[model samples]
Target: MGGPDVLATWSTGEHTGAALDGKSLTFPTYRKGTGPGVIVIHEIPGLTPQVVAFAEEVVAAGFTVVLPHLFGTPGKGLSPASLATAFRQVCVRREFTKLATGTTSPVAGWLRSLARDLHDELGGPGVGALGMCFTGGFALAMMVEDTTVAPVLCQPSVPFAVTPGRSRDLGLSPADLDRVKERAAGGCQVLGLQFAKDPMTGRRFDTLERELGEAFLRVDFPGMKHGTVTIDRQQEGVDRVLGFFAEKLH
Candidate 1:
């Protein structure tokens, strides 16, 4: 609130210029620490200081952390202008599947490719992925691949939920949903967090409960907080993610 650079002071971790070059897409990635692998997906506002701080926490917890600059400026703080810019970009971006159901975001492929590359390089119990806000449901979609051992969804708000049917959508295709269900049945677990009052999330968590049953662990925060993990800086939610990564990726 003081200055744009005020949030810059909270910056930690290193960019290292590491990237994953899929055939079509290329992500300008950031990396830090040295241990098993963990991919921390930023929300619609992109890689802000709070998000970077969360990644740094993962690094300090002893894991190699990779944060792709999906959109927005890295190290930038939340401001009216920044949020407006990001929202405009997201609305027009072809990669994000908004106002649609039973479909996965095209960007999920790039993230999946990133996960594969990270696993190949880091090499451990597989890789942990934590998707926040716009990228939230992406963790679930990415789980269709075997390399993503741990997937966390924090306030996933995708597909817009503009209609009644879309309100219950978690932004996964039929096939991807089936695969995630199978993985859940096979003892794979997922962690999800959201606020009951978050209009952006709608009834997506309810869908997850129905689809994942016992395998999905829903950490519901009842209040006005919409961005659970990073934007609002919920310590408990952050700690839960770190603990989940330790248990799965360690």
Candidate 2:
């Protein structure tokens, strides 16, 4: 795969699909693998090769993977310009909650609906959800619903951390947070990965520890690398996510 700056050819082969939300939000999705369902939400710069590579890993681990294009152009590489462009789009889009605290992105409801549909189709005990960067905390929100059995949050930076409250917020409403906490306490282990030096994550991991207790399995990296699991690919993080899905979904 090429770097984020390079434009990669987009495809719509066997793995191509879309999730329609009330005739409004048509989430263009890609899928691969077979077995349990795993919804991998892309970061700010969209479903780049790095993100797809990570999803391919999930598929290889004996699970079906769905990659959603939330922000940027699919197959576009991540670069400074791409990041800025996608970030800007997120800011202006009504579907995404860009600069607020304790509020789920409007698109999350659509994602939750999509997960349930997938679970019904896949017919497993439940499904796995991995959301990175701008979509990271999305998995946590999905846990409030029943179908998401495995929720892995990798450097889930959202709401921009523009304020003190948002820096520690999970980007969930109070009711949603309570539901997620309840599920975590009920033995639903939530996995999280972050670079110790990444300021974008703020104190969200700490908040996770406080809310979910031992159920929040946090894996922290050593540097300021933003996307610990993808663009800044870390095999350890990848293995952890895949293992968690295997343990929880299968």
Candidate 3:
């Protein structure tokens, strides 16, 4: 199916100084109604048109959505090489490995702060998070605090280590996993979505479900491909995601 049209657009500003590591991180936000807060973390390609559109859909659902431009400003899209370079840059400056391990990374902290600010601004006690592709596991890490996080992992990446010692490269660390397990045991529910054929996220789903037990809820779209689920669009998988989030966060 085709993606939805751009519903609306609003200007979001850039961050200066050490907070943004001297790079400008600015992104546009498309909103609808307002109530709870939901943070949408984009894929490695950065915030694409589809990603922003998804945020718009969340807004339509009566939740205020924020899509942070972890990469940088809009217009210039990153090629594969540039993408890798950007990620490495973020890693070197932000120590992303530490963030994945349950300690907040620079970007993760920004997300948490944004969520909290949005929750307060929107007048809610909690908020939801959605992470995709390279960011999928980050949402899980955001849930460690629980006070502001209710997360949805869509096609999460970086969980299954390709080589020895690679597990450390995942966004959620062992300590974070332990915390997630504890939270799950105590009644928190963590949901995941993936395409059955998407090799990148398929293994992650298996690993996380086994590790998270009942706290993990996974929905596999038998014929869907990666990036198929966009915001406010109608698709079986998208419907399932909305339903899942509605049940868990609404």
Reference-based lDDT, each prediction: 0.82, 0.83, 0.62
Model 3 steric clash pairs: 54-231, 100-171
Report the lDDT tens digits of candidate 2 across residue range 130-162: 898889999888898899999999998886777
Between the candidate structures 2 and 3, which one is better when assessed by lDDT? 2
C-alpha lDDT of candidate 2 relative to the true structure? 0.83
Off by over 4 Å in 1: 1-23
- TM per model? 0.90, 0.91, 0.75
Choose the strongest candidate by TM-score.
2
Using TM-score as the yardstick, the better of models 1 and 3 is 1
Task: Name the runs in model 3 displaced over 4 angstroms.
Answer: 1-8, 14-32, 72-95, 98-106, 159-161, 164-170, 228-234
Task: Rank candidates, TM-score, best first.
Answer: 2, 1, 3
lDDT of 3 by residue, 1-250 (tens): 1122333354454322222234433334433456677778877656656676666667777676677667633323446665676677555654344223324344555565566666667765578888887777778777776754467888765534454333434465466668777887887787777777766654666667777787788877775466646432337656665665566657
Looking at candidate 3, what is the lDDT of residue 126? 79
